[model samples]
Target: MRLAPGADLPVEVLERPDFPVNRGALCGKGRSAPALLARDVRLTGPLLRDRPGGPLRSAGWPEALDRVAAGLARVRAEHGPDAVGVFGGGGLTNEKAYLLGKFARVVLGTANIDYNGRFCMSSAAAAHRRAFGLDRGLPFPLADVPHTGCLILVGGNPAETMPPAIRYLRELRENGGKLIVVDPRRTRTAELADLHLQPRPGGDLALALGLLHLVIADGLVDQAFVAERTSGFERAREAAMAHWPDRVERITGVPAHRLREAAGLFGRAATGMVLTARGPEQQSKGTDTVGAWIDLCLATGKAGRPYSGYGCLTGQGNGQGGREHGQKADQLPGYRSIEDPAAREHVAAVWGVPAGSLPGPGKSAYELLDGLGRPGGVRALLLAGSNPAVSAPNAGHVTERLRALDLLVVADLVLSETARLADVVLPVTQWAEETGTTTNLEGRVILRRRAVDPPEGVRSELWVLRELAARLGVPDGFPADGFPVEAERVFDELRRASAGGDADYAGIDYARIAAEDGVFWPCPAPDHPGTPRLFLDRFATPDGRARFAAVTHRPAGEEPDAAYPLYLTTGRVLAQYQSGAQTRRVAELNSAAPGPYVELHPRLAARLGIADGEPVAVTSRRGRAVAPARVTEAIRPDTVFMPFHWAGAGRANSLTNPALDPVSRMPEFKLCAVRVEPLRSQQAGAEPAGADAGAQSAGSDTVGVDAAGSQPPGADAAGSEQAREETAA
Candidate 1:
């Protein structure tokens, strides 16, 4: 991005012509990024509270740092190191994510570390490993999307989330490729599809099984590839055969004929691809759901070829890198499993520590939050780069958990909702003033060059970590060069730690990143160029063959019942980003999507006696959310949609279920059961459905809004008084 001179902030964010991903193009979020750098909307100093639930006041960096370090150390002393939890974010640079995990395990001696990426694509990652023996968002560069013969786009709406990617879809259609969209709503991306399959929410597994059944029934299965390059197909085929077209039609809302057409369209194409996103990956059965999709790709021989495969369209900017370089609960750098003795030994040798010293895997995102301040749970927590108060599933309960913490420390550019509850809030540097690297969805590692110096009171997360480490008694780091305050130094250590692991980055340096625009992972040596397309000749498994998951359809965590008769699904809008911690602060974006509104089909709205623009309460077993009604036929009559970006009365996550996927540990955010009722009292200027974040200047002490009614949903009395007394001791 080119910066313009003479301006207080770098307002001119020029799209680089040299970038291959979006050749001279950017999405609305990219265009409006500068608004976040505005002085009023950003935090420029440290904030501290002397007591829990006390007001946050401005404090010098030293005092704020001391309070955070002391508070955390105190909790660890009384309750053990595992009592301190570190929560990372998907948007953090690879350097920060790596160090965040390292600090948790090494400096704090805690195994309780995880990230928000758990909410993004952990399901797909789990399935990828199950089938291909490795996990990378996309094994091939996104440039191949335009050359495929057919694309089955499942659960993702690139038109809104990643607008620049639409170019490739248009090119594919222009080249005579068919596009099939699978979603519960006819989204903008669905409008461009050759065939749109509007299934009921959480019915993707059934739809995929039905499609595979048709492929087998129509003799579209590639017998050659199946015989030579795949295993366990017999079991998978048996599972698919049980869900015949008629049975699948009963389970999912798609017609039997439409299933046949979709199968034929995808199977007849010489080369095909299936790309899934959060919609199918955020369910309690997400791993099995993705496995079903992959099974279809394998059945039609749509994988391990130049323009064919199953890939995940990752939601966050650095989600791929974040998961790879150690922030995930079960992984170390290079996507190595934490439980593997060999993997732990290698990473331990690199960190100059004993392999046995490293702690075991911790709780997943929701599980960790759910246990906060409870019996034998985390007592002190450190969170960075994420706003879980407005993002996590069952958010009202998550908020209460945050409030019950003995000490909460948050690092961010602005006062996000989560930061408001912190005992200490540290103002961190923004992207333009921070030099770091991020791996994109395609597994390409790219350099993010700093364009300007940070304003006087702001500091980089690297420096903050180093300072905290020093206070915790690990000043010079294990290797003597450890705990360094520079991004490049942290990255250098990360490379060595990830040397021979699956997502190897030993050969990728910052210089190489800038010289090549970006470098794909597994660049094991300096002279090695990179692997642009993987599994072209062989899979990453020991036997060099892809394995099939014998998965079958299952009900969502909470199916729509008589009490909660409608399915509530959540997603993004063109004008907002996740949780709206940053995007909602922008005036232009908020004007486009002023506040939260419930999107329901006209059929459902009419039955509920609700009109367009009327206020309605979306209630579930967890909590209730009131929002303006947007009655349209674009969505399925059985499903209601809401954007989770907003807070206050319209907070969608307040009504979501927190059921965790057994394998991926992903919370069921995409599908849940709910009931909607008209809120006549709140319809006309009687406290709008949501907070106008753009108009409200955020302060560290501000709770943002009356978040979830009188008390946060599921706000139980925390640990017994004896537990608190023990912590105080």
Candidate 2:
């Protein structure tokens, strides 16, 4: 139940059931989504620049499209297909995402096309594919979470990060189910856990190995299941036994007694599920760590049951769907391997392109950004719905290279930090003013319907890309005579591409979507109901058996030392979203978390003579930033937490290290050594007075510390230092 545009209503009245609910009810953040659609700063028309520093003058759609086509053609002709890379984002609609891959493979003849999802979820995807022969969220539906005897949460902070999923956790708790949480920080989710194991940062693999060691040593492993349903168990067991409780304790900082207790409880449970997030997947050895986590569930025979399996809690809005539809660097639609000849042939037949038209797999996100500004590197970049300046690891280097690009194109609803630097800014429609489908963490597909018209000049990404294709004279482009006019057509194309594959969605149609609020994938035919679980009897592999990956613990690429004695981990706050492009503009949300601040242990702060809300300059080997201190017990004494939303004054990315995993190539955004110092008297007088004043200054401007030592104003300094000090000590 949603109200039409211009329907005046009070907040309290809208909250009542008597008044119409907005699209089956919205969360606090969802309720404010309508305001994002009403922003006037949207880029409606395209603009072109004659020179690098020239002003961007508005041009007709045809002119803008022609210029883009000509520029791309020239780059390809002069350098090569690899010279022009396509960097996509996870926020695009399913249709747009599908087309982005298609455009890169068929039209550009370049395999150098990858989405931002590579940076966010590639490690989890790679690990799951290696272990389970499948990469969907969980084997069972999200509804089954509440029925489990025990739930093991690793790395993730679902209590604050994923509010929608919290309902199931609450239901499970009400039903007397046990919750076990493992993280370096005692996050909001940890507070709700019956048992919480605070492991050291980048020590997740060691903890997982220790749990497996205890399971096997105590004779808790399911021998029958391992013998019949898994491979390589003997080797995995050997690896697990190599890391005893004492060794794990030394590496992970978790007491050997506590780990054994948690292991006993988990091994004895009749049914259990394991969930992991960035804490496990944002490391230099992320893939190996995730593999160890999956191995634990398999060893205990917890997968493929009603409420049991290993799950990766994805971060992006459409992270699952984006990877499924060939937006990844080495994947075709349907989770098919890009290097597999048969899979490539099948996709080529459906797309009506030459078998060899698709270029070879491209470089990962870290490599692409690192290559920028180097010899034979990317001269231009087209950013779709991403703010690399604030989100990318080693952001100082990324920002420097971004400024060196010959051309930069950014497409988004608002002027994000990345967009503010674009040579051409294209205004796009927001979610509330568009219609499509998005696959959530549980693999449930839901409709994204438009309740109001887009603001003046704003157009759907589909419309913008289609116009560009026509201008570029792309062969057999979608009908140019008129607009697609319907979102269902694009979904149908995705359905065709995904048929008979791991992420099959052929059964779901627009009519079914309208009739039902949502449906899960593997909906392979019109009459078939969606599948809620997968691999119940036989695995998806040729042998119908799950593989046991032998995993080992490895230290993070960067470790704390004498100069930088604390590990800095990056994450999101409850009140802010990624990069805060839209949420920061909301007065209420902004007031809740106005700016960035470092969360440190009170003991660490006291040692450095830093008070709560004091300004502290946090510097890594790669870069540095100055943020307000937040001494709290949420983190360990030798560890710190910082949000990655802010940019100018104290962006987390600036202090992040960019060392990547060899397998997944995901940057180590979670663990990096940093030195924190109280800003001196000279630095304390350099800050501007207000938010607007600070933002107006460049990223290099001096930021003064307040009396309490926090950023001058607009900085978040909630909670007390005593709690942090006591917890750390």
Quantify all predictions' global Cα lDDT against the true fold. Answer: 0.85, 0.74
Q: Tens digit of lDDT per residue, candidate 2, span 1-729?
A: 443222232222134332111224345566665545433323445544556644445555566566767777777777777777678887777777887787777777777778778778778888888887888866677778889978889888876676757767778889888898998889888988899999889899999999999999999999888888889999999999999999999999999999899899888899888888888898889998988988888999988666788888888888888778877778888777789898888888888877888777887887887776456776656668777877888776677677677667777776566665566667777776777888777677777666556655667777766766665567464434322344667778778888888888888876687676567787889888887788789777778898888988878898999988889998988777877776765656666777888899989988989999988777777766677899998889989889887776577787787888888888999999988888763254443222221222122211223334443111111011112211221
Q: Return the clash pairs for model 1, or none.
A: none
True-vs-predicted CA distance for residue 576, candidate 2, Å: 0.9
- Location of the lowest summed lDDT over 10 successive residues in candidate 2: 713-722
What residue pairs clash in candidate 2, if any at all? Answer: 43-427, 507-523, 613-710, 614-709, 614-710, 615-709, 632-724, 633-724, 687-704
TM-score of 1: 0.93
Report the C-alpha lDDT of model 1 over 288-384, residue by residue, as the tens digit. Answer: 9999999999998989998999999989999999999889888899899999999999998988889999999999999999999997899999999
Q: For this target, which candidate reaches the highest lDDT against the unseen true structure? A: 1
Q: Which 10-residue window of candidate 1 scores lowest in summed lDDT?
A: 711-720
* Local error of candidate 1 at residue 483 (angstroms): 14
In TM-score terms, candidate 2 sits at 0.90
Q: How much lDDT does candidate 2 score? A: 0.74
The TM-score values for the models, in the order shown, are 0.93, 0.90
